[model samples]
Target chain A: MQKTWNNKAWFLVLPVLLLVAFSAVIPLMTVVNYSVQDTFGNNEFFWNGTDWFTEILHSDRFWDALVRNLSFSVIILAIEIPLGIVIALNMPKKGVGVSVCLVLMALPLLIPWNVVGTIWQVFGRVDIGLLGHTLEALGINYNYTQDPFAAWITVIVMDVWHWTSLVVLLCYAGLVSIPDAYYQAAKIDGASRWSVFRYIQLPKMKRVLLIAVLLRFMDSFMIYTEPFVVTGGGPGNSTTFLSIDLVKMAVGQFDLGPAAAMSIIYFLIILLLSWVFYTVMTQSDAEA
Target chain B: MARIDLDHIRHAYGAKPTRESDYALKEVHHSWNDGGAYALLGPSGCGKTTLLNIISGLLHPSEGRILFNGKDVTNLSTQERNIAQVFQFPVIYDTMTVYDNLAFPLRNRHVPEAEVNRRVNEILDMTGLSDMARRRARGLTADQKQKISLGRGLVRNDVNAILFDEPLTVIDPHMKWVLRSQLKRLHRQFGFTMVYVTHDQTEALTFADKVVVMYDGQIVQIGTPAELFERPSHTFVGYFIGSPGMNFMEARVDGTSATVGSQSIALAYAPAVGGAQKIELGIRPEFVRLQREGLPVRIGKVEDIGRQRIVRAEFEGKPLAVVVPEGMDIPADPRVQFDTSAINIYADSWRVGSEG
Candidate 1:
């Protein structure tokens, strides 16, 4: 017997495809159009052919921002991953204490990214902010507005405070999902506390940790709102991440053609990095 | 091999259990012989697992001492106890190969590489996992993972005891039988003190040399399968250890006869009762003889279970199950007779001494 096939199923997904086309694909095409062309005011466009791409590829500004983004992501990950695991380890397994700890950790995650930046901006001020005032009173000048080191400290601390909760939550979920059986097995094996963490807890948490790493990396790499609101990519562009640079080109300078090309480059970089992370992590999962 | 002694152990989760009834495990004092296979069998919320955890040093007893080979290990951790536990679910390192998972404990103790390999290989052979040694643990079936868990527990020769808490629950039925037999073989081969915890009566009966039946918060009975079946120390044991559990009929005992709702049944021995109020007759379905002439019973349903037909009937208004031969005919008026020699009398859930 021959089977009848219906092609109308494709129509069911048409709305979703249209939505994606409008929101993402159209915008991406516009960026691509701008990338290969030169535009002047009064809606005039000239085919510049690969000139913007070549310029962006050779530009030191793009490289510096990329390096800064990579370093920031690496540092944030290095600090957050282990810290999150440790926090998760120390958390109460069961009872009201678990709920209390969860709520407390989630408090920062609930605050919008821009709000987090605003809070940190006010809190790290030299004159009125408690932390800055206390540091000044201790005979230490901690002004994030003017000093590069202070600005870096402020940005790093702000990032940690805002995003560490995500890592914590993921690690916590992994920890909670581990049946008491594993711990029991570990105990019976005469496993030392460190060995238990290494052989049992660490391996079990690998999947979640990978997610936390990818999320933190993407967020830190594309960091614009917090640093822009706090330092305005300033104290001599010390805190100017890739997203900040991209925004400066696209919005501040308003050189639409070059900025659009830069935006495409930025988008490609994120897509490539995220793809790499996903592939590596998922491949390891498959191997395991 | 070491003897484990639980001395007056009592535990309560909350602070200061003031009353005698406040304890979760009420003063369990028992001794298990070296290299003995014991099963702690009970329903959930029966404190069987709690006692096992306490014995494993996962939980600290609120009161009393646990001695492993005469050394007090009540305050010690599970690592100090030198015990290997296989939990209900398989707890293997999913990222590691089966060989690596088995080799983990040995390597952690810094055992020689060749020796670790030899031991792991031997365990893999024992667990029927030799073919899948190089395969990662994550992709294997559930039962296979459980086998890895068992192998991990059994790999360490220096451990004093191996504890299993419902390790076969996730296993398929056929696999469960094979594993149980394998475990029995392992126990005999290794001569390790093994304490198995399960709610399944068949598993406990087949696996353990001595079964510890728990009820409420106390150890109801601890004996061999034969002893548990023939002479259950408590009513809970009589009810728990059998498939169609022992039927209890409320009766008035007088000399060598028990009157069950005006029907007098002869007993081999008289019930010892001076002030005992609630006397009950306990008898298993296997012991209840279905004869043509005896106390009248209304047969309600018959279940033909391959080997035998279980007759579900009402004897003097109380439900009773009688196991007869597979091809036996159910008479129009079936009469059941209690095997006098096998009958057990109980007073308030505890077995009373028989007066001959």
Candidate 2:
């Protein structure tokens, strides 16, 4: 058999390549360009190699924000993953209640992120908000504006309330795709409820859970909108995540070189963590 | 093992079942014998799986009771009933090893560890999965996974019955034969009250001692393979049981004589069909003998199927099939004689008895 080698087929990918260069590559290259340079007023630039990266790495503000970001991601994943599985397991498998429950679950995910932030901000005000008023009437000291602990709690709660639905919806999709035969077999096997979840439901939901964990980790790590809108990194930088701090540096003080360096480090950390998560999960999946 | 008595069992999927059409399984009142192998044979949507589920207690019938060993177990769950079922597709714990998969049912019931090991090893040997016992079930082929499903059903020693719903549908052709024979051997050795459900006639006829034929949500006949072949109780049974099926023709009958088309043939005995609007005479292709002088048929195409020849012919503008021995010659003036003793008379699709 004779094979035809046509290099013309490479032309088919030209449009996508150009679109990706314009959308992602060019912007990323600009950040890379800024990270290794020094800039003065009037758009004058000088070649400065790795000075901003080293300075950003040594700064306590950057390290503190990174630690806070990692902790928040860990907390969100730990709470949301198990909570999502439990809620999905308890959801109705059939009947009119299925649609109703699905719609309710999707409601939290449909609201814009900033709107969610605003809603929580108003709801958690110690002086005028419903939750804060109730807590105060019950004789609790809860004011997010002045208390660092209260600010952290308010931000964490707001993030959880806004994002837990994504995990729930993903786990629900995994749960529903499992055929009824598995449940029937489990019942006939004399399995207890926990055994059914452990062996059947959990195993069936493994892939979706991996996806949920990865998505929640990345999204919560880079989170700035909802928390900033609600707390504004208040109470002495108690809830200032990496992105919030980066924006404060770049947009607030116009330190483009250091901010670009910090942003690149943040992106690399997320990429590394996500890759580790994906590989570890898929490896266990294969070995199992 | 226990005798399963379905006492006037009926099921309707809809909440308000006002008419007979609403019922998925019409009334089934029959007792399957203890330690007997039975097969429920039917086409798709014929209520076979519904009846199987009812027997396994996965479903609660809309009407009537199910009894195991003369004890009413209508309200019992599948676990309480102590029945095991293998579904059409293999249901395995993907994270477990083959050995662990087989041991799952026993461990779920809190069986002794020693007993679990014994039963799991025994099933592994029986299912030819001993070599793969340490391998994860997720990596195995479909047939091996299905074997795990069957092994799970067979691991328990005290189950009331083991129900199989088309368990061999996922296996390859050669493996299907091997697994079927293995199942038959297992049935012989254990004598469990097995009720295998399938749409294939060969599987039902070969695997079961008594084949229960169903059509349109009703059991038309329940008999041994030979009995079903020799005497089909309904026209549907006659059509569904055999290859090329039984040949049916409109007939007018009086005493021991049946007039099919223009020729009148003598019957073995009188069939009491009193004022029935429709009458049909049915004979299997194997029983339609080609003779020198009989009702004339225009021979169309003769099919030589290795061991036998099926002569396709037309009689009175109706197609007919006659099975002839290999190398038998079709005479110049072709004729067919329906074996009198093998003929069945049907009135309104129901076979009429000689006593009637």
DockQ of each: 0.67, 0.89
Task: Let me know the TM-score candidate 2 reaches against the reference structure.
Answer: 0.98
Which residue pairs come into collision in candidate 1? none
Q: Which residue segments of model 2 deviate by more than 4 Å?
A: A1-7
Highest-scoring model, lDDT: 2
Stretches > 4 Å off in candidate 1: A1-11, A127-129, A133-142, B19-21
lDDT of 2 by residue, A1-288 (tens): 999999999899999999999999999999999999998878899999999999999999999999998988898888889888889988999999999999999999999989999999999987889999999999999999889889888888887888888988999999999999999999989889988888998998999999999999999999999888988887789889999999999999999999999989999999999999999999999889
Please estimate how well model 2 matches the true structure, expressed as its whole-model Cα lDDT.
0.92
TM-scores of all candidate predictions against the true structure: 0.93, 0.98
Interface RMSD of 2: 0.7
Can you tell me the DockQ of model 2?
A: 0.89
Docking class of 1: medium
Model 1 lDDT tens row, A50-111? 89988988999989988988888898889888888899999999989999999999999999
lDDT of 1 at B228: 93
True contacts kept of each: 0.75, 0.91
